[model samples]
Target: MMDKMILKRLMNDHKNIAILLDVLAKKNHKLSEGEAVNFALIRDVVEYMQVYAEHSHHPLEDITYDYFVKKFSSPCNQQLHEEHSSLAESSGALMYSLNLILSDVVISREKLISDLKAYVEMQKAHMQYEESELFPLFAKQLETDDWDKIKLQCEQRLVDDPLFSDTGDNIFEDLKEHIEAG
Candidate 1:
């Protein structure tokens, strides 16, 4: 039951995160076209990803993937682990870039747009790889004991989704409103 819940939550997070990525893509498009883009929305999306996706979602996946590695001994597990850490690093760097731009530091617009596009593509690819390849393996092979251990570890450090959660201190109010308006 807990395993199903965890998997379901991860999948749901992918869906929500995907929407934000699309927003990023759109903003990148606007910038590439020399049009005004909402940097705040980009920052909000990146911040949410840093907090929820990096600190929360990726760690939960690490827990699951760690257990999976122990059980299955697959060759691709190392790559999976690295991808999580790499993405977290990317989010941090992106957040720093956003902050600099927000503070009126002269960041190159083309560089920022390139970074956003690359980050979005990496995220989409990672999620797709997990959903298509790893998730099915997890669904079929992860036993009750594995699930129990993963659940316990996950429960120790769960972070709530700020934008989508009813109980979170929603700091990204404008981003949320924009999402809702569409």
Candidate 2:
């Protein structure tokens, strides 16, 4: 079975991503008003989503889903895999738009907001699906060996030098603290 601790940690990470999504939404709103885009902040959010959310979260699910496909070969695993594929594509598109925004390419503010909103919506829905369906299946049906493989893959995929660290010394901490204190 998947480790309960790992699962919980993953959920916490998802929560953090949700929080970041809210912040990004606000930032997108400001940008649409022709306010400063805050490229550094945007970069941080993009890096976090790409590294922790996509790189870590998706690989873990991929491993878990692979095991499920091997054992079940049913519609459940197939459906989840299809959703993952769609999520991955959306994420890639979001990243591409973010890059353009950062580079000061003349992207329409409306289009940027729309794309960003789409990414956030898709991710939130994807998480809900996993928590409600895939996670329970994993808790009930996954073997210890299956979990071990997941852990190994997750460890291997972890970025040793993340583009932006969450160290207390960073500006992100200050931003988060300011948001919390308000």
Model 2 per-residue lDDT tens digits across residues 16-126: 777777877888888777887666666567666766667776776776677677777755546666776786787677678777877878777787778777877877888
What RMSD does each model have against the real structure? Answer: 1.5, 3.7
Best by TM-score: 1
lDDT of 1 by residue, 93-163 (tens): 89999999889898988889889888999999999999998888888898777787788889965767888
Q: Alpha-carbon error at 108 in model 2, in Å?
A: 0.7
Give residue 141's error in model 2 in angstroms: 3.1
Clashes of 2: 1
Candidate 1 — which residues are off by over 4 angstroms? 1-3, 73-76
Pairing residues by index, what is the TM-score of model 2? 0.74
Q: What lDDT does model 2 reach?
A: 0.68
